[model samples]
Target: MAKTASDSVSLTRQAYALTDDLMTPNAAVYWIDLLVSAALMWGGFLLAATTSSLAIGLVAGLISVLALYRGLSFIHELTHIRDDEAPGFRVGWNVLVGVPLMTPSLMYEGVHNVHHVKDRFGTALDPEYLPLSRYTPLSLAGFLFVALLAPIGVLIRSAVLTPLSFLVPPLRRFVKQRLSALVINPDFVREDMARVRPAWLFQDIACWLWSWAVIAATVAGWLPLRFVLTGLAIFSLATFVNQARTLVAHHWDNDGGKMSLDEQFLDSVNVPPPNLASELWAPVGLRYHALHHLLPKLPYHNLGKAHARLAQALTPDSLYHRASQKGLFEALTALFRRVAVKPVVAEHGRHAAE
Candidate 1:
């Protein structure tokens, strides 16, 4: 007999129940890691500005971009973290990364929860999902290309759209529905603009104020143009790396149908044997994405241990094994190859019809 969704859920619950002790968040570790990430980002900017050597600056910038990418990834954790577990971490993150980058935590807070909803995953309602595998190679390219321009788009939203939206209710509604989301699926529409939460409102205002302040400072010669440009460059590069990671984060093969809990896990991706590359590229527990869908409340720091426990508890034939990929490169190549072969398959089908 085949294992059913209930069986998968039962197995996962059993696996996690054994690792229950690991779920507690270590406040000290979280703070130290976040502080170090911020230092790396700002330290890169300082190195780039103070150093005359282009090579040195480039190396420092690359390091900073990688660190910033990891730092920003903590936003995903914020959505899942309980306030009692890590007090003030969310506000600190907003001040350190969100306000400066124009990607406030509020944008992802309520939004990402939808992706984890059992019935919503891979559907139009899931903000974080899209059916990329069904599209042509050209469409895939377009998707990534748009992602490359995300930094600029974020800046525009903060500097231009954010303030304008506040003044005009219609524009605010439009922005809330179309722009405020941290989503990949274009079809995911947010219809809850009128019921804005206080935290979201506060974060949005902070982002707006910080964005214009940066612009004003740059224009008034208070902040150097080169510094501003360099910061934007780092943000752009980091966001691009994130976009690339998002591309291969899953199989992206779902066709807008509701999936069972087991099917949802199968649809997600997990890069096991966590190494340096996985740590850097898919930081903040993203490498265990499929497992995350299974156990949403598990803190990021504990994901590794959770994986270990689950791997040992589950049999070799578990659906967990199906979601594991060798590494980032292999996963991306698989996606690309899938897109490339899609056209050929469609052509063959057309000829068969003739």
Candidate 2:
């Protein structure tokens, strides 16, 4: 049964009431998880770099992807974290994971929250949204293919664009507004017009120096070229894994229109238990993504507990239950199966008109 507007309101209220106690961000959990993930990622990358055996390198490479993917996923949590709740964690994450990965928190912090806005959710204006189901299957493949190039793209952005932008004020403004954000929507423009922010400026400078150092060291023969290439390969794999996970994150059913809260929740998905692989692919509590949409402020550590609470309280036929998915494959399959040719014709017509 389709959930009525009142039922959505009731569900939203119940969600907040059931998980209000879980709202407090646990700094200890944040620090420990970040540190452990960093260690595993670095350790795995080092092992892969040093190992001679192909099998050992492959295993180590996989570990690096999973570890780094988990660590980088913290960027999402950092955005949702209250300002006073996890003090210094943002800087710590930038230093430990973000800048190193070439995906600093600033790239996502100002951008992601917009995706959750009532009017923006699933709309073309939403930086993180795209109507995938409305497109051809070829578009889906193109999306994944583009994700493969992300590491190389960001490396160039930091190494070349960072210094070049400094020399060109107009370019600086352009970079901050367009290139700085991590968004899926090509047309989304950043609203930031301020001259300076110490936080993002710090990350930009750090990444600039680090990116140049890596390139210079590799070119000057100070860093082994093979090792650098291996690391890039591993990073690319991690990125591709994330892109695959994203393909099933939501239904991508909405056109360019405002949606009610219930409408947005139904469009999103949650791959809870019996889908343990989600723990690795959708790390940092992303498996409960739809639920996260409801409790935006809920810490990642408590997402599972909050999910269980809501599940036990809500009925089987409730919107909460309907939001859940069995696994990633099922969700992706469902999304692609709904694709239509009429949307393709409309899309081409729109492009031709332009």
Candidate 3:
């Protein structure tokens, strides 16, 4: 980041101060919401996989997918939180949502922090970023379709490669560097695993064992093929939905350069209240992506209130108001408009969605 980038954080100070008190994450809120979402996910998944009626199965499957998506979205919160602040929440989340879904918190834990750095926020180094708006419409179509591969990719990573990598140290290193992160940028290699070895070993072993158990159960006829297939389909659908939300999470307007904190905030997006659809699509305070850029430490439960306070306190010309989108459709329409016309001359780091 440019030295000026650090100097200009004065622009964000008010937002930070306004939301200072909101940083305390409510433990009760996290526990209740997480457990309820898990229960709904498992219950709906069972009905969807085993029910006799096709219509009922389809409806239950959709609900299950949405619930699972919401549960998985908590990984974002996990990434921001310190273990001292919210003791045991991360472990509970992994046991309930991450391991079962094949997207253990390890996939995102040590990786997402880089995206928040001013120098890296929208540049090639940002693992969570992809310059999607500059891509051709056809390429964007492929982007959505390709996200469906997430389930198979995770299964291979956890089940097949984990054990093989353990046997071959070089393969283990390669896997850790290349495939360990839940990143959009495939080239983003992880270098921080040594810092997280204990947690990594725990989650990695659990995921490996769970994957093998599922496979063994299917092979031994202890678990129905239909149920396993249905679960994959549901997880794949959830991945697709997340990718769709990701498309609107940011404007993707940067051109692979170090940006000021203010520039990074504008580059992001926010789909705030009265937009009920946003709650379904961008769960877990993600709807406030831009506000999040401003107050990244604010807990998910407190994001809405923080946003309202800023909206009322800040003037109409403030950056906070500009970050707010009316709803999902409006935000998506803006993205579609950007992609509708392929840029005549794309620059370095401007490519198809990751």
Per-prediction TM-score to the true structure, in the order listed: 0.93, 0.95, 0.93
Candidate 1, residue 292: lDDT: 85
Encode model 1's per-residue lDDT on 1-354: one tens digit a residue: 576988777867786787789878897778898999999988987898668999999999988898889889999998888887888898898898888888988778778988888778777677887777766777677677666677788889988998998899899888888888899876667766569688888888888888889989989999888888888788888877788889878887776677777778788898978555888888888889888887888888888989988888777887777889889889888998897765322211111100
Root-mean-square deviation of each candidate, in angstroms?
Answer: 4.1, 2.3, 3.3
lDDT of 2 by residue, 1-354 (tens): 556878888998999999999999899999999999999899999989999999998898899889999999999998888757978889889889999878898899889999988877876678888777777877777787788889999998999998999999999988888898888887778886466888889889899999998989999999998879888988888888898889888887777677788889898889998788899989999999999998888999999999999999988888898888898888777777777442652331112111
**Clashes per candidate (backbone, < 3 Å):** 0, 0, 0
Residue range with the least summed lDDT across 10 consecutive positions in model 3? 344-353
Rank by TM-score, highest first: 2, 3, 1
User: Order of candidates by lDDT, top first?
Assistant: 2, 3, 1
Residue 296 C-alpha lDDT in model 3: 75
Task: Tell me the tens digit of each residue's lDDT in model 3 across 221-298.
Answer: 999999999999999999999898888888887656667776788778888878878998899998989988877788
Please give the CA lDDT of all the candidate structures: 0.82, 0.85, 0.84
Clashing pairs in 3: none
Clashing pairs in 1: none
